[model samples]
Target: MIFMNMIFVDREKELQTLMQRLNSPTFELVIVYGRRRIGKTSLILRAISGRNDSVYYYATERNNLERFREVAQRKFPEVRYAREDWESLLHFLRDKVVIIDEFPYLIEEDKSILSTFQRIVDENRDSRTKLILLGSSISVMEDVLSYRSPLYGRRTASLKVGELKFRDLRHLGFSVEEAVKIYGFAGGVPMYLTRVTPPFLDWVNRELKRVDSFLRDEVDFLLRYEFREIGTYKEILRAISMGKNTLAEIRDYVKVGGEISSYIKKLERIELVTREVPVTESVRSKMGRYVIRDNFTNFWFRFVYPNLSLIEEGTYEITEGEYANYLGHVFERICREYVRDRYRVKKVGRQWWKDVEIDVMGLGNVKVAGECKWSEDVNPHSVLANLERKVERLGHTVDRYVVFARSFSTKEKMEKAELVDINDLNSWFMS
Candidate 1:
């Protein structure tokens, strides 16, 4: 087991929001949620660190009213054990900040927990106590906050904690190119990145190629925990990671009979997959394609999962050979995400014109279009001309055309567009 030092990176904004809620004059019921290992518990603990009146309870599958009261009494010794309901518990301990972590586990054990919470929240409307409920399952969290739910419209604040940004990884002491490679493998999940040390490729090789590796079983565990149709989910993810992005294409590849929208939606809710259309297209566009949004998941399906037998035998020659092809897509995704984060564009996505496609395009105050090349050398003029033609073919005028490449040969400058090599990624982030 590789033990990583617990390091808290950037959550300044989230902390500020939570602090603001805690200091509010009225009662506040806040909902915080995200996928597993995205630092939800760490964020909450950090937010409530110095508070003396805070009570934190981690609900488990076996948790009941008695279990809750037992935990609460640990923090507040004056509480009586006779009260079994949440309402009585809250009334006894009113005006004290409380946090319930893994709240979905409690609901799974007792489905009527929401109704009980609804009553507590209603009675505590004028009280100054702040109640926070945190969960990892996105679908269950949404169901608890939905209009049909008893607790709907009762929360004073709701926050969906997302993955850390690429720019934030600069604190990890990696150069632009190295950070790109690490992000390609681990994305921004704190728990995933914790296991990664220096010498990125060596770490990658051991984690993915070795039998009995923790990461080898992570995806399977995550899917099986949240979904019932494990086989169908695996097939669907494999199809998308292998480049079958469209609904029709994925359905054909999986050969499942039922409607795939629900499965895909479930994946999306858990932050595993994303549905994207052209930047110019509307949200209702039928031209959307689904892609596995998690970098680790994408990399696993593409390289590790398919070659499990070979990996088990301690041979990774085929996987190592195909990894270069896999990095091409990673490079494109990094470039597009960088443009979106740095440029603050209205829209950033891939643009497809029939058979032609531009890898990254930004439409905003300054229209920008780009192509990513994970090659030894890139010809700036040829790449610029191709992008120009594609922009023209799409009947769109771009204010700036950028080329992202590993290295450049000409040592030349362009009058129409900009050439950005791997070294310039840091400069872009700073800008």
Candidate 2:
């Protein structure tokens, strides 16, 4: 199972946009950002794979401008520099492809870097350079392009890199069950998926629970980069992961007297947290609930964050005990992805109201009511009975009914109800 390949799975759209800009005859100042390990660096590298005119420099807090200048001088020895400074370096690379990754590091080291970039973009308007400024700090990058920032109105293209789809996990050469286990933790992040192997539980114990591990500080690193106030965001995320999803529930959990709607709005904008309304309800429905949406982060907060002392004491059983419950939600997301494209399901989501909740509500040309069972040994008849009751309470008739489970003893066929087990999902999804 190769997970570190170059842009093979679900990045074709982003790669196309980048290649189109890179091959153009005009200047391009593109701003690209996403959370860490989302493959922003890999996409850019693959875009300039065979191009001999590209220079990729990763900036750091230690100040790498000198190293970047040295690299420019070494890469293009023909360009003469009158003074050894940023202006000369920009002039030297103005006609070539340049990528400065982790642009926020420079911004942190010096506030004037943004202004310097604005000057570079302005001075090289007619130059044929494709200069892309990339970073993992979503807020900082978006702020750079805001109307009040120095680099505002100078970017020709902007992109926020996103996670791969659940369907793309089939190509990783794993069995259907193993694929689900991988998705349960990695959540389609290429960097995280690269650490997957046989015996998924062992991998979890070794990588995720190890002291002084990268996974231990992963969430903290992200929070530090993204927000000035980390305590509030962490509390909010922990609250959401623990089923305190409603606005009132979250506020009560966090014990905040003021409003948390603005904090949640910022998180939603950065693709960390998502608010979901029932499919049958309007977009402005007040019955919406928030969800972390990222499987890795949710798993971290649910099992790891609360049990930090237990993890340090080397007592892994308590953390591992609740993992199955966590995978229940993961399996629901997988089933949602399965039916999202079927039955002409242009949009698929969960449906919930006061007294009833449907696991999967697929809306399109044909509406589908679905239920997902993560554990292999689930009673299909009882599950179907519950789903029918919810659909009844939903007060609307669906065009089709389907049930998803890990493995079922009977995939008994029926006109109104379809039972799709693990083998069925494997056959239908594996390419």
Top candidate when judged by TM-score against the true structure: 2
Per-residue lDDT over 1-431 for candidate 1, one digit per residue giving the tens place of the 0 to 100 score: 22122335667778889999998999999999988888888888888888888888888778457787888888888777446778888887789888999898888888888998999999999999899999988888988889999999999999998887777677666777777777777888878777778567778777666667876678887786577658888889999998999888999999998888888888888889999888889878887889898998997887778878877877764343465667787788888877887678988989886788999999889889999988768888888888889989989998888899988876467776778887777787554
Displacement of residue 258 (Cα, Å) in model 2 is 3.0
The clash tally of candidate 2 reads 0
In model 2, which regions exceed 4 Å deviation? 78-85, 318-321
lDDT of 2 by residue, 297-416 (tens): 887897778877877876764344466667888988888888876676988989987878888999888899999887767778888989999899879799988898877765677778
Candidate 1 C-alpha RMSD relative to the actual structure? 2.5
Q: 400 in model 2: Cα distance from truth in Å? A: 0.3
lDDT over C-alpha atoms for residue 233 of model 2: 89
Deviation of model 1 at 300, angstroms: 1.9
For model 1, the stretches where C-alpha displacement exceeds 4 angstroms are: 1-10, 209-212, 317-321, 341-344
Candidates' lDDT values, in order? 0.82, 0.83
Clash totals in order: 0, 0
